[model samples]
Target: METMIGLPFTPKVLIVDDKPYDVKILEMKLREVGCQVAIATDGLSAIEETRKFKPHLVLLDIRLPDIDGYEVCKRLKNDADLKEIPVLFISAYGDVTDKVRGFESGAVDYISKPYEFEEIFARVKTHLMLRSLQIQLEEQNKRLEMLVEEKTKELVEVNKKLAMLDATKNELLQLVANDLRTPLTGLFSVLDSLIYEELKDQLTKDQLKAYDKAKQQMLSTLEDALLLTQIDVSNTDRVYGEIPIQQVIKQALNNVRPIATSKSVSIVECEAKDFKIFGDQNLLTRAFTALFEIAIRFSARHERIQLQLGTFDHHIELSVYVIGYTIPPDYIGTFFDLSSSARLNILGGELGIKPAIVHRIIALNGGSISVKNEGPAGVLFIIKFPFI
Candidate 1:
């Protein structure tokens, strides 16, 4: 007898036969090849031992004293738990009709007796190998199902944490805007009352100009804070439609003309064909106004700022060229970041949050904005929007 190697486990076999001499010989042959054997002398005892041993394969003899082997196979096939165990019939009847009956009763294979021991061992090895492969496949499927379930649970937890963080950020922005705007409104009313003809005559020319400048700065700060809060909290409620790019630029230039005139800065515009894009018209005007204000604030007296417009492929591009001041190298990367007040300090005023707000508005409308230093000329701001 040869020992089997590389099987998944030791095969368990049950021998069902009344002949003691044949059973003894077959049991010895199976044990030599690393099989665990259980013996049953009749059909009734075969069924009982099969349940207790839970064997991988069964070898049955048809001519038992009690119930026949064909009937025993039928009973095992009817059972939900035992139906998958492979059964082979070893009997004295070798006719074709007898073989058919054994297969119809759920026997996997048939062998006629007065049989050679070598042939019996060969058939037994084949069925045991097949049973081992079936068990291995079932275990692999169970492990794969468990892995998929674990990953799905992890994704659900991550999405829940992200939703909570977004809500907290919105609440904080609203609180800051409300707290600062209340005091600034009261101070603005006091300044307006001082502009009467009687009160104005008592002040010198320089004194009245300083008071006007202070009032303007306070009003601009209040407007920026309120708009920032609205963008963060209710930006989803916007009316989208087709907008003319030339019209949007005209509106922005008109809004910032007073500030540019006060600084003695000249805005030079290039004539180009009008282009159209899909977005909220009011929001685009606000974003462009902020960009022009920043350019005017950084320019020297009598310096020229240029606005150029062109089209490339399916996108419309707008470039704002400020000709006097270039951004410092260290602050270029974080120029549009929310916490970039240190960079704005170099410009002698605070304009950090305005850039962040412009970036958000552009992204919400499916556009993009970027700034780069243009060396001796100044800094260039480029904005692109899809026209289709």
Candidate 2:
């Protein structure tokens, strides 16, 4: 065969045979076909010549003056640096066993004693061409792997920048929500005073109800905004302590009494055992307040709002229920999601933080929350907490 494309560098051949005549014939033929040839009379010298010459191919005879061709081929293939140099066995022993042994010894193929130069040239050309393609493929794979690693690093940096931007936006939102709190507080104070003063006689029952509802909704918005700031923890890291659920409930009820009175909705603390859990008391108090506020706003006029606290499966179970409104079953699925609150038409006394902030506070305390609608009868908000 004529010269063909197989390697980036000039091909070199190492002929391992003790017969001077055999070595001379192969050396002349390989050189004529544009291959640089190196000679080794024994297996020991063949390995040495391969190292020095770094030939692209090796032409080995089965019988060497010292080590056999099988051992030489095995040694060449075992070496990480030399294994890619294709070894072709050339021997006078042309039995099936000899051919099998040659291949088992890592020879690419075996050639008979009275070898045809055309067969030699064809096998060498094919193996060398295959070897060159394997090397190119490995190089391409390494480059692809490196490219994937670089892209992964770039994605990590982008995520870090996005997180920083989110933190900045939350900070700005906290500032705005804080500024709105004071005026809403003042609005409630004035309304409460008016309904109790001499002007109380001048205001009709419906007008007083309107003022109360307005005050309650405004306060709900204020609390939501306030809770938004607390959600991220400001001085919250080291202030945890034991909090009695009863004490928290008492505070929430006291804060909610006026709203309940205005709506003519009655509230009662049902049968519950006293228990304590570890958490941030002030935050938990605000969380309970949000729960009560939601209950009061949702309860029908003159309806009963029942709150119960008990233990269940090593957990503190707190449930609030209103006698008539049935929360849609599908709404229960998104009950704790913040988007649900955000989508509410808040003017109808619906708060924009009910399950969102309420669930977050309980979750941060290592607890979980769930909701259920007892159709045609009532809706329940159940909050469970683990003892710290």
Candidate 3:
């Protein structure tokens, strides 16, 4: 006897027939091939055995002693638990009408009487294989559903944690900004009053220069902190419109001109045909001002910085070349990350947070900024904005 392999388990078959010799032959052949066989001489007995055996396939004869095979198939198919089991009809009535009725009664296949035992075995094997595959598919689908449910729950928990962290961070930023800005504002008022000619005469040239530099650095740091907090908290209320790129650049230049002059770093602006981009004009100008200030601060005295603008296929490009300084290669990767220790160390004091602010502002306006070493001794900052 050849053992049936490759199935998840031994195939169980239910045979329903009135003939004793026919039933015995089929039962012997099924058992020889490692099938567990159950016999029924009537339709009701077949139904009973099917429920008890939970067989993989059913071989039913049309003429049953108690109830017809068609009625048995119908009853089995009506039961939710038994419906998936395939029923193959084996009957002496080998007519087209009988086969049609068998199919209508939910039989999977129909075979006429006087059929070869080999043909019967072949049909049984095919249906058993199909049942095995269906069981495997059902098992796999159940596993996948379970996995998806588990992952979805994990994602929900992660999102909740992230939301809590974000809220805490915003609250902290607001507190820090309020505490620092109040003192800085009062100091600026005192400094403005001290700028009067009568009061100014009290300080020497070196004293005045140091006082001015200190004031500028403090003011810059305060402004950057306040702006960063505003950007984080009020993103939804930003005013946006189409603004000319040249006008924005000009405004930024004017804003940074005093510092640039103080550092003796001249900026050369290259003219291009004006292009308009959609963004918050004030924010864009502030971003550009921050970039120019960073370039100016890092450049040597009298080093000329070049500003150029051009249009690409989908976006407008602005490039600033700081002629005297190049960022070290390692720091370039995390230059715009506010939390990066390297960036904090390199751009110390008031300038430390400006790049991160610039990056956020550009991102909010659907723009991007990047910095890289250019030529032998210069750093280049490239900014791209969507063309309107």
Candidate 4:
């Protein structure tokens, strides 16, 4: 009630009543308690006084000269800007129905016309205190919401920058891998020949054997690295064309023919005659080469390596099998992860020969590669490609 006790600003009150005596008594009572008061003789002028005074609270009488208090309360409550201001109904028509209608009209409280001075003060004090608390809570909530929204925006910006940095890092890795391409291929070809030539000559046979094996492993590893790099760095808009699976097999067989002869290894081709697949020819060629090379290296002397071709669900698949070696069960799960290259290199002195690169290339082409141990000593590498 003491509106300007410790502050310069005074809280204003609006009193609306048709009876002149009632209006004068309520105004004097409110001003006695240090609250600023405005008087409106009817419902129409009450709304105008509200706009002009912007009172903290409104005390309205049920009967008015122009309009009833219920209609006035409804209009005030429905308005966007004025709805938040609390209205207390002071009515002479003391009926349960009138009280219910006044509440339905959105007046926060209803007071009887033959009102007690103390009861009126108590209700006003209670409603004003509650309204002040509500205003404080709304202000606090708005501040909290603004803080949360700002933090969310900051987090989004940070995530965006992190994603861009990750993309740039991958691009740099691909560029480095591409630069290694020419030398790696040349080195692999030389290494393949080295193993074949050393095994032929009797003079440096035993000593050169390990070096030759190491060279072969290194070559294979490089090939894997190149393929993995292509998987990440190469454009996805691929040149899809007809590729002869048989020709790829033949070329791969020709490349490893000398090694097979030296080891007395036999080849069993169950390759589909004139079988064609729709994909990037060069990529398919590299995939076939890797499988064939693995088959040749791991198979026993004089043991037959099988090249099989088939189709399922409109997808073409090429499978190569070696008879003597089974992939280690412990290394089965991560057999195609690039990180496995480090493990393989540590174990066998060559990193590039790991299937990590082949897996990446296959995945990039929307294809998949898998291995299965058919029997005690049979290892199958199955590659599936889109029918395209």
Candidate 5:
């Protein structure tokens, strides 16, 4: 068992000297100021007392019986267990060379023979306080390291769970999309037969017209649903290549030409020069078709819907602006929203899923689609594609 010769407020100190009177005076004074003293009259005894007593501070006399104080301090400092113990020397050698030699041999402080008790105590207290602060800081660093390690482990587990959940969500979306498309296909086939084939003669003109409208609406909805499953964000299927911007625009214009002509809405195409984008061509064509259809449907009779294409920085912009129409400012924000039904009253029918799907397709290709005001004149739909 370890001995507790030291009091709670006192630190153990080792004092080495050959003079009994000097030793008695220092021992009494140090003990009075809350220091537990261990006396060693020789260098060998001082080294032994340091290992045994584990003193926090040591006061050694430079001239001793067995070995000098410098030799004792060096030996104590060399030992692994005793190296951190602060050593102070009391000596008659007051020259600069003696003090430097004492410090180089690992004495923290070297005091001359005629020293005051207050000065000794002050130096001892300062060194002890510094050592105490060092120990506390080391402990705090260990605790902080443990906390960082634990938090990193927690984050790793959370990321793993999130990845698994994402995979499950994507799988469910694919299965439901496949299930819904099968019935939608059957309905489209039946509508085609009833409107154009077997039942054409038996149905009245009003009934035929109604069936045709229903067929068109269902076909439009089904087309959008199929497009959703094709891209779906998680789907990595891509047939990306360099596709000319004008070629896709021409195909879109051709598809929407009949609808535009029927509404007496003329399109003015200010063509883009040598503009190319790297993406799926078929999807891009559909996006352009949606923009053209929206323009034609909303334009007033004899109104000119302007199509302008130009390069801006690293991206190309294809804009469709209506010169004489302005949608409600509030509805402009909701136009690109997938669930908004405000377009139903404006279009005289539901807007279907055209606008939102086009937005998604552009975003999937690392591009953007926006509807914004064209000053006092109508609104503009801008489609952006970054050049590859």
Candidate 6:
């Protein structure tokens, strides 16, 4: 079967020879294999057409009228535009010196003539096939390089836009949340007063108890929202000082004590007695606050939540474990991802406790956190900080 393998445009060949019959024969042979041939009867015409035609390959005759093939090959090689094109020398002088000269003059191959008709056909076909493959390879490589460059540029542009959008979003959320804090705090105070004043003598004991519990939960939600907003605007890199492990864990435990009491859950604090680490007090307090809230909300009724702290190798580690309450296995790895906040809300869960934001804050202070679903009961959140 004949192959229809040529450029969609045309596979051009420039044949340089002074003989009319030789040029015609070569032209006819090349056209049989799907190539467009251009004839140049002199060296000067060859050079001129090389510039204009920009042929994919060149066939040259050594004994030209003006410049010999050796000089023509040298001149073609020296031209930057034509240097990459393959040149095959067609010569009648089959001497070894002529062959050597052809190679040294930059011709890729030398063909001796009076050449056999089939040999000429075969040699030209081989060289032209090679040239076509080479051209295709070069074009493919160029396209691949272009694709890689375009993808890299797109990634850089996307990252730049994301950084800008992140900054704007943080600022906007901070403003809105901050503006609501004062009023929310006042509302809590007003609720407290109303509960005592309006229902002092009119309510059954169970009704009063339920109202108080609901009121406390509302205040807890309000605090979480305010802290989350503040975190958005705060610079996470600023570490305050050494907060003794005992004090940090104790404070976190105290904040969640009321909720734990309501749920009848026990908290076992097992911090290393003397361990201390440098960190931002408010930030660490908030981190534990979120963790403690998670324990209180997720632990089974009458279950135990244990807080353990220890120091090892210039790092402080804290482990919060809730007994008998399991986090879903799939969520263990990315439970702290900021985007998981939406998932949590969708499941009718907490509003402001974003694991992603918490992870970022801890990371900024040279610390890390991980949650694992394994062991005795439920999930274990492990936090480690570099002892500064």
Question: All models: lDDT?
Answer: 0.85, 0.81, 0.87, 0.76, 0.81, 0.77
Mark the 10 consecutive residues where model 3 has the least summed lDDT: 342-351
Best by lDDT: 3
As a whole number from 0 to 100, the lDDT of residue 360 in candidate 1 is 79
Candidate 6 residue-wise lDDT at 89: 88
lDDT for each residue of candidate 6 in 134-238, tens digit (9 for 90 to 100): 878889999999999999999999999997888788777767666767786798689768778876787788988877767665666656556665666566555
User: What is candidate 1's lDDT per residue for 259-366, written digit by digit as tens?
Assistant: 899889999875756688889898889988988888887677889889999987778999998887777778778787777754456475546467777887788888
Each prediction's TM-score against the native? 0.63, 0.62, 0.70, 0.58, 0.60, 0.60
RMSD of each: 7.8, 6.4, 5.8, 7.9, 7.7, 6.8
Candidate 2 residue-wise lDDT, 1-388, digit = tens: 4774546767788899999998898888888878898899999999999999998889999897789999999999899999988899998999999999899989888889797899998888888788778778889999999999999999999988987877777777787778777776786678678676957899899998787767766676666866775686355453688888888888988988987898899998966566988887877887888788778766888999988888888888988988766665666687678777432643243666666888888777677888787668687888898865
Kindly report which residue pairs in candidate 6 clash with one another.
Answer: 325-378, 338-356
List model 5 lDDT by residue over 360-379, tens digit each: 87887778988977777677
Candidate 4, poorest ten consecutive residues by summed lDDT: 342-351
Residues 124-165 of candidate 4 have per-residue lDDT tens digits of: 877777777777788899999999999999999999998788
User: In model 3, how large is the Cα lDDT of residue 169?
Assistant: 86
The regions of model 3 sitting more than 4 angstroms off are 1-114, 187-204, 239-243, 264-266, 272-274, 312-314, 342-350, 386-388
In candidate 6, how many Å is residue 366 off? 8.6
Give the clash count for each candidate. 0, 0, 0, 3, 0, 2
Model 5: CA > 4 A from native:
1-166, 191-207, 233-235, 239-244, 258-264, 278-282, 312-315, 323-325, 341-349, 375-377, 385-388
Model 3 lDDT tens row, 317-361? 998998776777888998898887655567454366899999999
Q: What shift in Å separates residue 231 of candidate 2 from its native position after superposition?
A: 4.2
Model 3's alpha-carbon lDDT is: 0.87
> Candidates ranked by lDDT, best first?
3, 1, 2, 5, 6, 4
> For candidate 4, what is the TM-score?
0.58
Better of 2 and 6 by lDDT: 2
